[model samples]
Target: MSKYLISIIGPTAIGKTALSIKLAQHFNTEIISADSRQFFKEMQIGTAAPTQAELAQAKHHFIHHKSVQDQYNVGAFERDALLCLDELFKNHNIVIMVGGSGLYVDAVTKGLDDFPDVDESIRKTLNQDLETKGLEHLQKQLEMLDPKSYGTIAIDNPHRVIRALEICIGTGKPYSSYLNKKNTNRPFKTITIGLHAERAIIYDRINQRVDMMVEEGLIDEVKALLPYQHLNALNTVGYKELFNYFSGAWTLDFAISEIKKNSRRFAKRQLTWFKKQEEAIWFDYLTPVDAIIKKVHSTINAEN
Candidate 1:
C-alpha cells in the first residue's frame, strides 16, 4: 500500500484550515502545518492559528511548537517534518499537510534546494546592514541582484530578503539560481489541493479577518510580545504593523489599514507562488467538501 499526503494549500484566510480538518477527519489521519508564522507559541491571535475547537477536531502537528527566540529555519523544519511524517505514515497510509507558506509547503512535498554554506560573517554583516540601512535597502539590493527571487519570495519580510541577499553576496550567484535544482524522491505520493477565489472576494475576506483579529485582542497580543519584537518570527504582517503603531509612528487606525493592505499583498504573493504548481488540483473556495473528497478518492484509485 502506497502512502499518501493530502496537501491543502491556498492564500491566507481562504478556508484551508477548515478543509484540512474535514479531510483529516474523513481519512482518520493527522495534519502537519506548514505555516511558518503559526509556529511561534506567542503569535496565536495575529497569525489566526487554529482555534481550540478546530484543533480538538483533528490531531495537528507543528502548531505553536517553537518560540520566537529559537533559531528555526525552513531547513530544520524540512528535516523535522519528514521525521514526523515517517512516524504518522506507519500508523496510517494517509496524512494531511496544510499551509499558505509556499516555501515550507514545497520543503515537505519537494526537498529544499541545496546551497553552499557561506561564512557566518556574511549573515552577520547582512543583519548589521538591516539594522542600519533598513529592510528597504536590502530589498532594493535583492531587486538589483536577483529580480526573480525578489518577485517570488516574501519581499516585505526582512528575514526572507536578508536570506536572499546573503546567498547572493556569499556565492556571487543569483539567489534564484540555486532553487529547483533538487528532485528528491519521497516514499509517499503527494495529492495537492489548492482553494481559490476572485481577487475582490479574497481581499474582502482578508480585511474582515484582520478586523476580527483586532476585535479578538490582537493589539493586546502584540503588546505582550513587544519585548521580542526584534525576533525574526515577529517580523510578520500583523505584528509589525501594530509595532509601528506602538512606536507612535502611525495611528491605530492607520496601522490596522496597513495590516489589511499588507495581508492582501501577502495573499497575492502566495497565489503567485502556488499557481506555479502545475500538478495541483484547484477548486473554488466555496467548493463542497464531499465533491473534493470524491475527487481525492478517484485520484488515489486511478494512481493505484
Candidate 2:
C-alpha cells in the first residue's frame, strides 16, 4: 500500500475533529493536527482542542506541543509535520492530517512559497502604524498595495495583514504575485476533504461554541494567562476578547459577545481560505461516516 495523507479541513465548529477521529480510527492510523490556534499548551478552552477522551481514541500530534512564548510559525510546522509524517509512514501506509488552518495544511501538501527576506525596519514601521493609526489605516494601505491579498487573506487579523503589507512594500509587488508557485513535491500523495454547512448553521454553531467555551472556564484561562497575553500566539479570538475585558476596555458580557462575533467571522474567513484548495472534495457537515470513508478508500486505491 502507498503512503497517503488524508487532510480533513473545514471551518471552526464544523465537526472536523469528530470526522477526523472517525477516519483515523477506521484506518488504524494516527492524526496530525494542523490547527494553529491549538498549538499552544496553555490554550485549551479557547482553542477548542480535543478533550482527553478524544486524544485517547487515537494517537495525535501537534496539539498543545508548543509554548505561546515560542516563535512557532507555519514554516516551522511544515518542517516538523513532514518529519513526523516520515516517521509515521514507517509503520503505517495511511496518516490523517486535520485542521482549519489553510496555510499549515497547504504547507504539508503543496509547500509554502519562498518569499524574499523582509527588512526588520519595514516590520517595525508596520507594527508602529498598527499601534498608532489602527488596523484600518494599514488595511487601506494593503488595499492600495495588494488588493488581491486584501481580498483573499484575513485582513482583520493584524498579523496576517501586516505580513502581507510588509511583503508588498518590501518586494515592490503584490503579495498574491508570490503565491501558487510550483509546489515542492512530496513522497506521499495528499487527499484533501472539506466539510461545510449552511451559513446560518455555521454561525449558530460558532455562537454556541463560544458559549460552551465560556462555560468551560475560558475566562479563567485568559485571566491565568494575563501576564503572557502580549505574546503573538495569545492575540487570538477568545483570549484577546477577554484580555480587553481585563484591561477594562470591555465588560465581561461584551467581551464574550465579541468572541462569538469574531469567531463567526473567523469561520467565514476559513471557508474562504479553504475554497482556494482546488483539489479538495467538500462534504456536507452531516455527511455519513461510511460515505466519506468509502470515498477515501476509493481515492487511495485510485492513487495507488
Candidate 3:
C-alpha cells in the first residue's frame, strides 16, 4: 500500500478533534497533532485537548507533548513531525495529522525553508524596545521594512511581530520571502481536508467551548502555568488572556469575555487562512462525520 499523510484542518471549536478521531479510527492509524498550543501539557483545559475516553479511541501523538518552559516553533515542529511521520509510515499506510495551525500544517506537507538563527541580542533588543518604545513602535518599523509580512501577520501579536522584524533586520530581507517557495516532492502522498461551519454557528461554538474550558478549571490551569508565561509556547489566546488578568490588567470577567471574543476572531482568521489553500476539500460541520470519513477513505484509496 502507498503511504499517505492525511490532514484534517478547520477553525477553532469546529469539532476537528472529534472528526479526526473518527478518521484515524477508520484508517486504524495514529494521529499527529499540528495544533501548537496542545504541545504544552500544562495547557490541557484551555487548549481543549482530547478527553481520556477520546484518547482511548485511537493513538495520538504531539498532543500535550511538551512543557510550557520548552521553546517550540514551526521550525522545531516541522522536524519533529516529519521524523514521527517517517516512523509511522513504516507500518501504517495512511497517517492522520489534524490541527487549525496553518503554518504547522504547511511545514510538514511543504518543507519550510532554511531560516537563519538569530543572536540572543536580537530578542534582548526587541524586549527593550517593547518595554521602552512599545509594540506600536516595532509595528511601524515592520511596516517600513517588510510591508508584505505586515500585511498578513498579526500586528497585535508581539512574538509574531518581533520574529518577523528580527528576520527582516537579521537577513535584510522580508520575512515572507522565505515562505511559499516551491520544493521537491515528498515520498508519500498528502491529502488536505478542511472542516467549516456557518460563521454565527462557529462563533457560538467558540463561546460555548470557552465556557466549557472554564468549567474544566481553565483559570486554575492558567495560574499553574503563569510562571512560564514568558515562554513562546504559552503566548496563545487562552493563556495570554488569563495572564493579563492575573497581572491585574483586567477583571476576571473581562478576561474571560476577551478569550471568547478573541477565540471567535481567531476562528475567523483560521477560516481566512484555509480559504487560501487551493488543495483542501471542505465539509460542513452538520454533515455526517462517518460519511465524511467514507469520503476521505475513497479519496485516499484512489490516490493509493
Alpha carbon lDDT of residue 117, candidate 1?
Answer: 92
Best by lDDT: 1
Q: Is candidate 2 or candidate 3 better by TM-score?
A: 2
lDDT scores for all predictions? 0.95, 0.92, 0.86
* Candidate 1 vs candidate 2, lDDT winner: 1
lDDT of 3 at 184: 45
By lDDT, the candidates rank as: 1, 2, 3
lDDT of 2: 0.92
Model 2: residues >4 Å from true position, as ranges?
Answer: none
Ranking by TM-score: 1, 2, 3
lDDT of 2 by residue, 1-304 (tens): 7789999999999999999899999999999999998999999999999999999998999999999999999999999999999999999999999998888888999999988898999999999999999999999999999887876776767999999999999999998899878579999988999999999999999999999988999989999999998788988889989999999999999999998898888888788888988899999999999999999989887866
Give the TM-score (vs. native) of candidate 2. 0.97
Which parts of model 3 have CA positions greater than 4 angstroms off?
Answer: 115-124, 143-148, 154-156, 170-173
TM-scores of the candidates in the order shown: 0.97, 0.97, 0.90
